[model samples]
Target: MAYFSKHYHNPGTEPGTLVAKSDLGRPVTIHLIDYTEDHLEEVRLANAADCREYLERESKTWIQVNGQADPETLRNLGDLFDLHDLALEDVLNTGQRPKLELYDDQLFIIAAMPFYNGDKLDIVQISLFIGKNYLICLCPLDEDPFEPVRKRMRLANNRRFVTRDIDYLLYALLDLVTDSGFPVLEQFGYQLEEMETDLLENPNQRTLARIHGLKRELLVLRRVLWPQRELLTGLMRTEDPLIHANTQVYFRDCHDHSVQIIELLESFREMATSMLDIYLSSISQRTNETMRVLTIIATIFIPLTFVAGVYGMNFQNPDSPWAMPELGWYFGYPMAWGVMIAIAAGLLWFFKRRGWM
Candidate 1:
């Protein structure tokens, strides 16, 4: 896994070097939100350069790009902002854990957005470059999952992203990232119920494997998410002028989000462990039933085998009184069969009354 971790950077020898992950899909799609306290403009840019004019001026600008497909365009954006080399590298490296770094003049944040609303567990990597007056976010996917945040920005009275300091924009984005996890956890809860159903109705090795796989995915998510608690904690406690004093309260909310996520994860782990126990208990119950039936059958057969053995013994003649004289009786076979049936019936009735049949 060091290989994957090193994919974030090629060690700490240089500040701004290009070690972009080779597997990045393509150059990103660009969207722009140029807003002031009173006005807002949302548009899809044909080029990432279209926002340069707004960035040059003194208005709140947001140039959000989805996915990191084109390395050249990312490099160019880094150049346009005079981004620190390390910050540029962070933009291209898609696998880093959630982090917050205050570089030369920018607050570069790389965080994973957890999404489980859909079929699979989705984690979108979002790298934000927050400058003095502009905010540029590089999303790891082509789709925009921040429409709710965007909708909030459009409201006339609550255009906080436009009127507030760059820190508020960062908070909104991180809030979006952390908020997404709660829904994913909800979806996981649903899937876990499905797992339990399959376990109860008809347990199988395949179901067990799925349970293990899902637990492992949750574990991986836990590894990525718990550190974000510290990240938010650090941001809230720092005295950085870039982050306004009032912003700590918002960061506290984000910290609470992380706590909720951690608690949910712990709950899921406990449920999974309980599920395993339920599975084992079911198997033990089934095995015990089978053994009881077998023991009852053997008990019923023991006396019958003894009676047959006595009749099977060979004895020489009329002088041997211990011999089975019933063999010469007029209706010996019918009498023996009637006796056997009566014994069997009596044993069956006794077992039935005992609730062991």
Candidate 2:
């Protein structure tokens, strides 16, 4: 539920310098998936040097680094792949916006994978370096959104997946990451529907808070997805040889998915805003009804108070001819009581007829 921004270097730090801000104590894990038309192999590499044979082989290789390794390991990996220092630095610095950069020999891509854990949306950044025959993926955690893609690659009956180039693999990863947002957006849709019902029936402070929280989360989602749409568009439009023509089509599909996510976020935002308005209007209506009842009670008491004040006065010289004769009559008190009763009953009847009681 808290907002997160990218970590920047010190004011005087040189640009494109690698800075290690992650406090990950665990050792880095390098997993390699090397496959060809007729063979497949998966290995846990001991170090960057163990990847030399796979990089030289005539098959498609995918090297997945589980955690942000120590600075030395990252530098060694960068040297092995000839990856630019700036791109490596971006991989270590978390919370980067979704973007795509084309290097002379590799395509660098950063994507945010969003998922719903309990009631909050969690986003994990996945950085990829795609080259002619190999793809390097750097993830912050072991559990990633690409597990399904891995499973599919494992279960394929023919060479359909293994025979493809690395660009297709890049597309698969991007597609998986883009498609992950749908479930999170679906969860939000259900919650917003329930919230709208509550706002109409019985709104309270807690409901308003939830609405605001959802709005903030939606904004975060929007911030993550808008640039992603542009990133996909750029990938599709680029003339880089690393991205094949067929791969551009897949990127187009990913672009469409990003657009859908952005549209959903916008719709949810508008719904949250409407729920807030409904809550306020509900409170105003209740206040008006309460005031109406209080006004009726005060109006009924006005004439009764006047009659009591008139009878409460004292009169001198009661025996005088022009004195107040009713004060000496035996029926005076009863007549006054009768008049008060009549006044109350008449007013009650008038209110009942006007439908104001």
Scored by TM-score, the top model is: 2
Model 2 misplacement above 4 A: 314-357
Query: Local distance difference test, per candidate?
Result: 0.79, 0.84
Residue 146 of model 1: what lDDT?
76
RMSD to the hidden true structure, all candidates: 3.2, 2.4
> Taking the tens digit of each residue's C-alpha lDDT, what string does model 2 give over 212-297?
88988888888889988899999989999988787788889888988888888898899888888888899898898899888877
TM-score of 1: 0.86
Q: Candidate 1's error at 116, in angstroms?
A: 3.4
Which stretches in model 1 have alpha-carbon errors above 4 Å? 1-16, 19-23, 314-316, 319-322, 342-357
